[model samples]
Target: MKLSSIIFIWGMLLCSSLNLFAQQTDFKNFETRESTLDERWELTSESSQGTFVVVPYKPIYILPGRWSNRPNKLPTSLNPDNVAKIPNDYNNFEARFQLSIKTKITSGLLFGKGDIWLGFTQTANWQVFNEKLSRPFRELNYEPEVIFNYPLPSDASIFGLKPKMVGLALNHQSNGKSLPYSRSWNRVVFHAAFEYRDLSFTIRPWIRFSEKFDTDDNPQIGNYIGVGDATFVYTHKEQVFSLLVRSNMRLNNRFKGYADFTWSYPIKGNLKAILQVTHGYGETLIDYNYKQTTVGLGVSLIEWL
Candidate 1:
């Protein structure tokens, strides 16, 4: 998307969130927990270097054999799979890391009601089992986002839904690769956090900025990755449950979506046992057009918010 368009949409969301901020009420039903349910308003002390840490957004893990329908993509020159192309090796590993450009730190800034954070996350699909090819990288998607969050009064509703926090972000996501396999896009995302007792939900809707012609790698990316995604996170004592639904706004003939279901339990301080299930397209930029279902289980360092 063009840089100018991103700026324009960001400005509008900022204004809308600010106006809505004044109307939200305070929510106090669920006491925040350390696992996956960190309170958005939680702040750092002045004595600390309060910038947030980013990088590892999802808990870094290795899910061996992510079995997918299509064969993994490899550069023609690397022709390691002898056949040059065949069903994707059903024995690769999936791993991701998010680096902190100061994402973990949380300090009050901007209107003194919100915190600013910068973070980058990279998800890679690897062909680790293909020993002949020395295990090559099939795809790596990069996500860098600048987020500004404002705590809304947790007491009231905008459209009958209690709002807990509001956020605005400029996100750029791309696979650092070339043609026939390249993918990239930018968006301005607006989020509203809500809670009703133990049920907490986040509604995130974004506007993909206008891109110059011939620049869109995946013209119908929104149809796969979706127009927006909503996350529902619930806590039962120390157990955390989450469901993420990303879907096209479905403006008639154009509609597609994905669903991710996760169940996590505390394993140690900040560490949790995690199992993730996903079904649909856009699992990654390279698989933006491939539909598949995959299951992964591993230790999690962080929970999706």
Candidate 2:
């Protein structure tokens, strides 16, 4: 059987289960507990507040010694004009940092069940140790997105997992560069969040908007960066662990994917030590098709819940 067919069937089954269990679940005697997701998303009445309050969207960290097994010295694209003319003097080790934040734009949509949010994430790779390269910034990616979130019933469950929310987002990601180095894409994304005890899961599937072939940079990016991703976060005391997996979902020889695992432990108040290890493609927009393994140790200001 084809992998796409299997995925379709699985999705249908999941939807049916959600509907069935959601109706059967009892909420009368259920007492809501303190939930990390609720706090992060402001899902409940107690959690929701005025607009314009900033919050963490993704982990914010700086890795001073990020080592990559392979570096993409000369980035290439299907568009001949977009290919690099000469190889860059990139070091195997670089400094990496990410800053992500989100804020609620408005609330009380869909009869007071949905909220709109604006988010931005920026990540950069810096050649701090490459003195010969004049400590240049190798790559920078900017992602801005608008999201609509709808909270589920407090006690709603799909199978054994508690359903938290469902939403949609308009997302745009780009490496702000010109010529052979420019890479950008726009996506319409679907989001679902669930929880099982201290573990939280978020699944996002996206479809890219079409672009003109002549102007499209990284035309085959979908095959490398993937169509969807799943993030699993688990919390234990002061420690947090997360795994993010992305896949194109093709079962044949063209299959491609990415995986990132992160561990964060508290170092001080609101500050944590983080270690991240990633393997596969799309670590950066410039290296979207370049597969490599990288390990980074850093300090984190915020983490996924």
Residue by residue across 169-282, what tens digits does model 1's lDDT show? 899999898665667889999987777666778889999987654666766667778889999988786677889989877767666778888888778655567788888867
For model 2, where is the 10-residue window of minimal lDDT? 24-33
- Note the Cα lDDT for every prediction shown: 0.61, 0.83
After aligning candidate 2 to the native by TM-score, how far in Å is the CA of 68 from where it should be? Answer: 0.2
- What's the distance in Å from true for residue 246, model 2? 0.4
Alpha-carbon shift of residue 164 in model 2 (angstroms): 0.3
TM-score of 2: 0.88
* Highest lDDT scorer: 2
How much is 30 displaced in model 2, in angstroms? 24
Clashing residue pairs in candidate 2 are 82-180
